[model samples]
Target: MAIQTAAKATIYRMVMPDHICPYGLKAVDLLKRNGFEVDDRWLETREETDAFKAKHNIETTPQTFIRGERIGGYDDLRLHLGKRVRDPEATSYRPVVAVFAVAALLALATSWAATGSLLTIAAGEWFIAFSMCTLALLKLQDVESFSTMFLNYDVLARRFVPYSYVYPFGELVAGVLMVAGTFMWLSIPVALFIGSIGAASVFKAVYIDRRELKCACVGGNSNVPLGFVSLTENLMMVGMAVWMLVKPMGVGVGH
Candidate 1:
């Protein structure tokens, strides 16, 4: 069933800065485009809003209220919009892309393990490793983070250690095994399980701990909340593993 979202009067504001101010304008434009009547009163700060906030412990501007219900900040606002509307399609990947992505992940893991510095690994020296992992997973999976997911004994060590020792090495091993499919269908399942662990680790550290931190998962440039995205990604991999088990595609030489 589709979740019901509350009808809301939105307040989009940013602090004094032209660049930031445009975000509010853009939001107003989008909301209006979507058929919601844009009330300038909601956009502008009024004595009533100020008094409402003062009475109810609101200290932030650009705060949204739906018939007197508070709707937090920009991120919350965006999420609400996503729920209410659907957009046009962009690019769609063919199945071949997933195959290529898996092969690339395996190659990266193998190369990094050979002659790569432990610190290089710890510093997450292999950019290809993360790229391959993300691509193979369709930019869907994560290798868990600290303080966020399962917070076990294994997790504590990851926080203080370097990347080389943590993910890349293990990832390299598992990734290679996955591509090889040497152990029949076992390889993919094993890799998926390991990758799921990694995803959980990253997700836990970011969202649960509220750490607006960089994911040293691949290298950098991956800074998303480790929540539903992480879970969904792993679930996809799990589905792949099941497919491999049912239909073990004999390793074919890539042309």
Candidate 2:
């Protein structure tokens, strides 16, 4: 009964000995999920796939057609179905949000396991430390890209290009030191310095200059926006640095 009411859709996909188009499978799945009665057509050879493309005057395969109207590829089909498609070039905080979320969960889990409690002063400390380390690792993955992105708004990086390369390593060292509850003398200064610079840069870029751009916080190849998330990261570092410095002197709030 559901099949009788389903929309008729046609899909042309590649299926060969050495290659099978993943998009074709995705298209088929999408169609089925959206109550489409799909007429799955396969181009069984490379020549056949190329010929199909030439015949349609299209560059790629895994094409979908609905009721004799070409719906294009997997992304195009999604758009036709009114599904939200993420644009690669669009600014987003999703990556940063995911990183922080995972970091917080890890902190909570570890704290609970060690101290037999979910909420602890150490949990908050662990969250910030882990988040910093994770973000640094991401930037280190492609430092060239990260440096290029960092230079856009960072005043220090702009003046001294070497600072861009050094920033991730500094963050990593500071985070590791804080997590281990050691080397406050070294970690405090590094975190304070970088966090201060970062906060100023973000404030100038987003609030003062009002120049919209992608953040280099997660890495060079991210679409994270240069605003609140970036500021938050810097603020967290600053807070952590201050806490670490004061805790040893018996002047801080947390244990």
Candidate 3:
């Protein structure tokens, strides 16, 4: 529609000497983007802002008015415009689910190319190893963030601190060695050490202490829940480590 024909919106926001309300700018931009001509009103002082809030019976700045009707603040403006917004605190397993799903497909492809079969012991082995590498990649993206989250529930990380920084590198190294099927001595120890500590920490935090927390399995910023899934990841590492360690003997085993 033409600019003159667009709907009109009036927004009252705070733009004081030392502080500007970010949501006010967002509300104005949102209105303009959605075929509305915005009248951006600024309260330049604390007294003016407080008076506006008191008069309108609202608690926040960036209060929007559409056709003389109150439309609330930024988040409320989005809802008014029918925009889909995510709930930041809602639990989600999306990250781990995507990583594991892609890892499974990669393992199947690798197995088909190597042995002309998808359902094989090597495929299963590759799946676990690929998952480790994929999960490690997420952590490696932001080591500081990953370490901060790791310290929340990790036994060694909480005490040693530096261990949190070392954990992702350890996982990556072990994963690469497992894939190559070489350097078993190095890979086995790294996996077992980290895995045992992780499993114990998770069990203590969730099962014993009954604390509800987010899992750092995928990454530091992930919303994946800390419970069975996290425990399973650590257990998988331990299982892979033990199996690879014993495969050399006549009993026959593999990652």
Candidate 4:
């Protein structure tokens, strides 16, 4: 099939001190990829950029114009090109999936280094512990954002706002304890309690209420959907708590 070329597009972007606009480059690239010849215009100074924005009555930079018709910024250009443009608040699973994948890799590597094999029970435990820690860390980065999103679906958080803040810290502590294989007496209860509450909240929100919302599992800024990923995280915690409680001591220790 002959690749169809789009109409020529013009872009104006800023290149100032510590303020190189990334979307401008993206806009140029997208135009070229779609076979549109781009007239790349540079605003050399901050004053020029601001003046351009004022004249155009636009708020942001990297503005695009096609055949003398204003096409807005990078996102607008993308829409004009018929591409999937993700909303800032849209829900997705990429963040949680990425964290879990990385955790699994790290667990496998650790197990291989210690036991000279990848397939081991210790690896599974390590994977869950690492996943929990990573997820908690993301939430901790922006606790207020996480808490706000969490309150939307978390039953306990809805009742008590303080619990939303506490949840991340508790998750982090439980993950650390699990990884160290020490303080089972404390970690077990913490994991079980949080896990049970999380599972119930997710079930009620997604299944019973049928509400679609973003998950705070990866973080408040993330777009991870509130459903299977959330349920899996809670289930992992529950399983890890049970395993820690019943497993033979020192079985996976010192590795």
**Candidate 4 local accuracy as lDDT?**
0.91
- Cα deviation at 177, candidate 1, in Å, is 8.4
lDDT of 3 by residue, 1-255 (tens): 645688899999999889998888888888999989888889999999889989999999899999999999899999999997679988988888898899899989988887788887777778889999999999999998899888889988999999999998999999888888778899999999999999999999999999998988888988999999899899999999988866645331132
lDDT tens readout by residue for model 1, 84-161? 432223222233345446545545555456535333321221233333344434222443432222233225345554
Task: Give the worst 10-residue stretch by lDDT in candidate 2.
Answer: 246-255
Which has the higher lDDT value, candidate number 2 or candidate number 3?
2
C-alpha lDDT of all candidate models, in order: 0.46, 0.92, 0.88, 0.91
> Residue 54 CA error for candidate 2 (Å)?
1.1
Encode model 4's per-residue lDDT on 1-255: one tens digit a residue. Answer: 997766788999987777789999899999999888889999989889889989999999899999999999989989998998988877678888899999999999989998999989999999999999999999999999999999999999999999999999999999998888888889889999999999999999999999999899988888788998899999999999998878886676334
Candidate 2: tens digits of C-alpha lDDT, residues 1-255? 444577899999998888899999999999999899989999998889899999999999899999999999999999999998888888888899999999999899878877788888888889999999999999999999999999999999999999999999999999988878777789899999999999999999999999989999999999998999899999999999988866655321223
**Top-TM-score structure, candidate number:** 2
Error of 3 at 220 (Å): 1.3
Q: Estimate candidate 1's RMSD in Å.
A: 14.0
